[model samples]
Target: MSAAEELEAGGAPTNFDAMVKDMVRLALSSEYARVPIRRADISNKVLGERGSKQFKVVFEQAQRELKRRFGMEMVELPAREKLTITQRRAAQKTEKPSTSSKSWVLSTTLPQAYRIPSILSPAKAPSSKAESTYTALYSFAIAVISLNGGSLAEQKLERYLARMNVDTQTPLGKTDKFLQRVCKEGYLVRTREVDGGEEIIEYTVGPRGKVEVGSGSVAGLVREVYGFGQEIGDSDLEDDGEGGIRPTQVEQSVKKDFEMRLRRTLGMQPLRDRRAADANGVDAGAGAGADENEGRRRSSRRPAAQSESDESD
Candidate 1:
């Protein structure tokens, strides 16, 4: 039944508007710390006794208001990681992994036109270096973990950060505390394994990190750090006929190959121009000259080869 119908058939009357305001307040409170708001908290705090039967209506209405007013909406959290062997076994038994975390986090609902960095840059509200430190630590840590094939051993990760001088004197406190903060904030997930009394700790991208600072975000950081797709420090140049690297050939080689190499090194997908080329080639051979048709047929085998290469990898 609809919310109005439920209220009309009700025992005690619910203040629907008040409940929606409470839901918005609760979501905003949770979002201030970038933590998720639990469903139970909503049921108890936002819905209360009278609105319990109208929870669905109340939640949807609150979402619409959030999007309309704040340009954000509460997004349901993905399922918790199945870390233990028992959890994996249970998933296998069920033939489907668990799909919900019973929690929601506020995510931007802004239109693409308004989603640029210029429109969404941070304001001066941090008030302290430590707050900015928290942001930087998680962002770089998540990028490092993502670029390191989805997980990094604790020792290796610490070494990487240390090389960049992110140790004891970091604005956020000690290195250990920095790591603890990210783990607690759900930007990184830690797993420990014990074998022969040797404890190994590893870090992986947490669900929050994936949703916020994913591979695309990582790539954006890379492009902003280095000039877009350019090789850093040294160009991987091509040799011309005279046994010297030609700048013209170097440009073509980098254009065709450097991006793929960079993405491979960073564990990201290659640039997407190949897809556009493929799309443009749809039945294109029918209208081409004999020489062009020959080249087109030659190029057509490349996709098949690429498919096999991807499968092997």
Candidate 2:
């Protein structure tokens, strides 16, 4: 049936055109930007009920009028796709596949020379050692989150760590310790909810984690280690002339600020060469003082021996 016939059948009021126009104007206003523009939303706000035949007719008429008069079209936002249990598990597996034998060997037997500065490595001070461990764990957690589309299930995180052969037994399990520390230190945020009578935990990079992992330096490290870029959810970033993804100006500024903060937090020294220069300076100063003392004693002995020789003569 025609619009007029449908409106007549639906018993729309004589001033339906004006009312529809007003409803459309209100729906398109900035005040409704945060709330989605849907048939139900418009009906509830304008017609006082969602299931009214008059409202449906008016909604259709408004949409057609808006398009014809103002060249504006009403479009529905895309709904979020819900994944089934099998699909979710498949996605997790694809994101973090099992390590290959060759890769495992290379990672496990990698020499100290090949390790990065902020990565886990041998350190003299206990605090430095702890920092290295934390850094490694933080990097891993961020990588996992990024790989799994900016959030990781807590159980999947544990499975991924186990697959990577992270020692979970020593010192009360590094994986558990890392999770606790990251949450406490604001490097990662954990969200918990009950779904179908079961508690589920999810992890996402927190503010501190973003600062540490999103910087240019850390991005390079992540790319080198995981073969991926540092920007989270930046699958659309364009490649530069150098065969690398170019970061935006805002990203560059953020990275610079993060670098400065990291330097200050880590004692303003290179992660790989921390305190080495200070130790060398102390050793050199001590050696120089000992040499001077020895020289003075020798001169005093020489004078005393010369005086004795002259008396004997």
Candidate 3:
């Protein structure tokens, strides 16, 4: 049946299908821009003025359509900012703020096996030079802020950026404007506070930032930043069972400093694991040598005993 026929067959909502299509489109636009999609935008742009109450149904349909067609789904973002001390105390006497920001960011729904580099690598993704620069800058910024207890002083941030030759200007604009654009796009949150008469500015990951380039993603990238050198480790060698050894070093990233520090603090296990097979091989060799020596001694004693027996006879 045609859409008109379907509508005539008692589809109560007048523009439900159109709303769903619009919803998907708007969501894709927001995702491509690397910004969070808000419910208000959906109510106004996609669902029309009267359709504000149809958020749940429209959202469900849009999510299903996105997953089916694009292998992506919208994830509800957490609160964009933490509650201040005063706000927290005020909330104790009244209704608390919502855990969700009533916004969403699109994320992949594809299985891990299907997300290889050739299929979805950064090189393959469509991006302009400005977008690429913005992504790298924000990703590094977020990673730094997260690693540094989820906050970094503005001065320190600038220093770090300066070290990377980002002090004066960037693809976006001057360094300050570049940082402002990142904050404006919701990739990072910048706040000012006064402590002991010192006005300090700090940067933290924002809702869109956390959802898109989360800590896990940052860590994955960092691990590949400076991979292990050509130096072989115990893990490289494997006995072929027939006596030959095989070298297996699947290329992988290794931040030796972080790894060693973490390992030493936690379990103290060396990065290169000692092979039990090699130790067992040494033990077996010693046992075989001992057996040969025993056999020689036994043969010598037997000759003497045989000679003595013959003499007695």
Kindly give the stretch of ten consecutive residues in candidate 3 with the minimal lDDT sum: 299-308
Better of 1 and 2 by lDDT: 1
Question: What total of clashing residue pairs does each candidate reach?
Answer: 0, 1, 0
Residues 158-213, model 2: lDDT tens digits: 89877765665323256777688677655577877677999888887664454334
Scored by TM-score, the top model is 1
lDDT of 1 by residue, 65-163 (tens): 787888777766557677756557778899655588888777665543445435554434554455555666777888788777778999999988787
The residue ranges of model 3 lying beyond 4 angstroms of the native Cα positions read 1-14, 83-94, 113-127, 167-169, 226-313
Q: Where is model 2 more than 4 Å wrong at Cα?
A: 1-127, 168-174, 215-218, 226-313
Cα deviation at 15, candidate 1, in Å, is: 1.3
**Candidate 1 — what's its lDDT?**
0.62
lDDT of 3: 0.59
Residue-level lDDT for 219 in candidate 2? 32
User: TM-scores of all models?
Assistant: 0.71, 0.33, 0.66
**Backbone clashes in model 3:** 0
Candidate achieving the largest lDDT: 1
